[model samples]
Target: MELQQLRYVVAVAETNSFTRAAERCLVVQSALSHQVARLEQELGTRLFERTSRRVRLTPAGAAFLPAARQCLEAAERAAAEVAAAVGEVRGRLAVGLIPTVAAVDIPGALRAFRGRYPQVRIGLRVGPSDELTEQVREGTVDVAFLGLPATARPQGVVARELGRDPLVAVVAPGHPLAGEPVVELGRLAAEVFVDLPAGTAGRLQSDQAFAAAGLRREVAFEVTTADSLMARLVGEGLAVALLPSRYAPRLAGVTTVAVADAPERVEYAVWSRDGRTPAATAFLTAVGIDPEAGEARPAPPQEPPSV
Candidate 1:
């Protein structure tokens, strides 16, 4: 079967409407439908069940869909590789990161990457560290930025350590502990707190620290975004939160206290172990990382301009 036929089939399967699929494929409805029909006939089975009301994938279609997608991806990667050999980078860059990443300025990095490789399409996903790590391992994400407890490392992927910082206590300006220069985990445990969901990498750092100290803090609020909802909770004097020291300074309306015995969180940049796309490598370079060495590269010194 032709690659164009496979593309038509995939588009129809994803959109679930022949007309919409044709629009997406930049072809007329009849041409797209005819190609899909030809593909099905060649395979001697109907791929989709078509009714005037709705369109659904048949059993055969479901079985064929995944392999079809793989083929399309392989074809795209081959083309990208061919272009890369000539010192051209053109592909999609899928980036995933936790909300609290601090080692690199993500927006600025992306802006530089876009200026350098304008042909590459960029997509970003914000998620928890664990989920982003998994996406990197699964090849769905080209690269990811993660923050995990110092005791843990990203598994089954190529990773480079970005930085590490101790957790700090965030409290409202008028809260009792707000004025403290440094606080112990035990003391923070005695107060109500706002934190990330249990078992998430962000939450686990504080949880493990408290458990090690033989203390339990009541989490009055469990939120996903620390800079937004969790900060709001702490700012309103409802509860306190434990966040990475580097990130805490960015939160307004809250006071950050040093945690004398707080758990440390490590930030890492991870990518697939199998290989990296040229676009992914270009992005890592833009951020001053060496993808092959898994380490930060020294910035090039500026040269004096000729008069």
Candidate 2:
């Protein structure tokens, strides 16, 4: 039988009058009566004894009232739960982050977001910018912290630029260059260095900076992950590394110096979807970067007229 039929049966039993039950259900008297009658027939039981003076539940009707009430209650609760899961503020959310975030600003952002939306269960994944971008594109993750130069923007993906985290040189303590308060690119270019793996954002940034200076880094080694890069810089004592300043600042055995000429890494965020949905909106607000606010490029300079 339909849910309304069960609800009508319960209401009629409780009110002990078809007229009152119909009014309570905001339906015409005949409609409520018909629904109850349909339910009783479907159940193969006579649920009420009717008389000209009054109406009363039969033994079968009395037995079914509690169960019918329970069924209606269960249905309403199921509807509420589904609504909550779909658009309400309570449920699981998946987020992806670049490695730099675990070291820099994300922990605080996550702590604050958790406090704001306690009912939301957050799942976080961390990796390089390339992988995180792909995850957001593939819908493998709901939202992610990413660096710019994303290889592909999946259709309908939205991005927000949080801020820039510039590249810095990380040299082991006691290294000759560590004592220099402000180490310039010219100095760094001559030093032996452990470079990021070729083709990665970090490596590209390093190459571009050195190329601009008309110098090349003495690349002694290379690594793919930031953690590996940090560990190697500490363990090997062989060469310095170029890393996001936020990550470098957290390492104890390393001295972080802003690369005077290294191109900054622009941090951003990408989400697979968006709208007025509660969790999606909150997720987008937190780490999501604004794309419209990219590095402000200067207008072309006008050359002075020749005499």
Candidate 3:
């Protein structure tokens, strides 16, 4: 019946341990258990089957979990709204970033935001663009930076593009394609590639491009979203990699060439369509994004200078 009881139930469901949930809620184990027990009694159905080894949610508990989470979220949003009305920006802010986004100066933005709102706690999570977009949809991430296809947009999220990052082919200095200004993707069908893993925006784009050209891509090595590793692999002549032009200047021992007919990848500032916290809004502004205007500010063009 009470909000605290709802919170306790949700916490227990998430952690699956009364003691751990109590620790998370900053309360004693007995008190937390008593509150959940009271709620179960009033509802006249056992929510959880607790054993010494583990705690599992019952059928009734499974059905109630989603509504319980919604209630807690609503309460938190209400509190945030009231605090914002008084011009206070003190709360936790969750931010998501892709592993290879280089256009925005994230550290600089965080520095300025800290100077302005010292009380706001910041949590940063890095993942592939697809994973980050899912976190945004789940309400776990307040805002995110995502690299997406030119024609595809995530549903139910408000996205503001910061800029487009053109894809380029990177290879060692002595590689056969190193001297070329632009190389067709189909030409590399026989060459081994150092590619991003599946479920990433870059990988998705690469797959679609090769398929369209009727070329079966061969990846010699699969890597996470770390650009440095990809650069190192390509610089060593292990395999060629498709990367953003922003990396050309920094990656030594590598030549970056344009991929002929390759599609440009767009980076977006994505957030939930619902109300956002004032702190999140301020951070967005600090990062050079107008949250309300939703304007498209293109990044400066990157030409792979001879490096």
Candidate 4:
């Protein structure tokens, strides 16, 4: 019936508990219940059924939840668009970065963005590429930097190539293959591999590559962080891991090799594929480096070399 009423209903539908939804909505439990009752009365259907142990959405509530969310989101975006016109990109801009991208460029990119936009609140979250894509689709992030595969992309996400970060195999210094002059994925099929958890974009790519080569792969160990992966690779000599080339330069005493037949992992700028906003436009321009612009912009003058 009203925006507040819609919000109350949506919140209750999401949390499935009036008390919990009240906490999320920052209102008292009694007030939330009253509002939801009013909403149900208007809709001619009960949104939630209460029980001693738990709460569940009724059939009517399940059907109306998405529309409620859409209404709120559209109103929020509309207000944000108007705010953007005044030359201020004010609002919390949530950004999602894949682990590899976060490792290499997030700091630099954040520095650049913050220097230009001190007023805009910036929020950063890092995860694997697949998770990052899901966040973008859910509107959990305003922009994302991820290793999205070029084949199939998530719906409603506009991906612009930021750059390609090559994936290299990392081996411990004392390992048998560490000093090899030639490195190939085919040979490493039997060697243990340290992989990010399943469903990660990087792991997905790695798996697909192995599949293409007609090989079955196994993970010797799984690590969630780059540092942990590097430590495992360097200290145990237990398995070889593939990560962005940027991380390769930082891990000392590890043998990094280029995968000859593997596809180069690509990093891209992902945003809501709909609507234009100054913040989004400015961000895209700041990060976009055309891979084929034909003309190289003149470099900034460097200090003369020390005599």
| Best-fitting candidate, scored by lDDT | 1
Scored by CA lDDT, what does every candidate get? 0.88, 0.67, 0.83, 0.70
Segments in model 2 whose C-alpha atoms lie over 4 Å from true places: 1-87, 102-104, 115-119, 149-156, 228-232, 273-277, 286-307
| Model 1: lowest-lDDT 10 consecutive positions | 298-307
**Each prediction's TM-score versus the true structure:** 0.92, 0.59, 0.86, 0.76
Give residue 134's lDDT in candidate 1 (0 to 100). Answer: 87
- Model 4 over residues 170-279: C-alpha lDDT tens digits? 88877777666556778878888888777766677788777888988778787776675555565478788776665555666577766666556776767765544455
lDDT of 2 at 104: 29
Of candidates 4 and 3, the better by TM-score: 3
Measured on C-alpha atoms, candidate 2 has an lDDT of 0.67
| Global Cα RMSD, each model | 5.5, 17.4, 2.7, 5.4
The candidate with the higher TM-score, 1 or 4, is 1
Q: Kindly give the number of clashing pairs for every candidate.
A: 0, 5, 0, 0
Tens-place lDDT per residue, model 2, 16-104, is 89999898999999998887888878889899998887888999988988778767745654554576677656555678876665222
Ranking the candidates on lDDT from highest down gives 1, 3, 4, 2
Candidate 3 lDDT over residue span 5-35, tens digit each: 9999989998999999999999999999999
Model 1 earns a TM-score of 0.92
Please provide, for model 1 over 39-129, each residue's C-alpha lDDT reduced to its tens digit, 9 standing for 90 to 100: 9999999999999987889999999998898788788889899999999999789999999998778899999999989999899999999
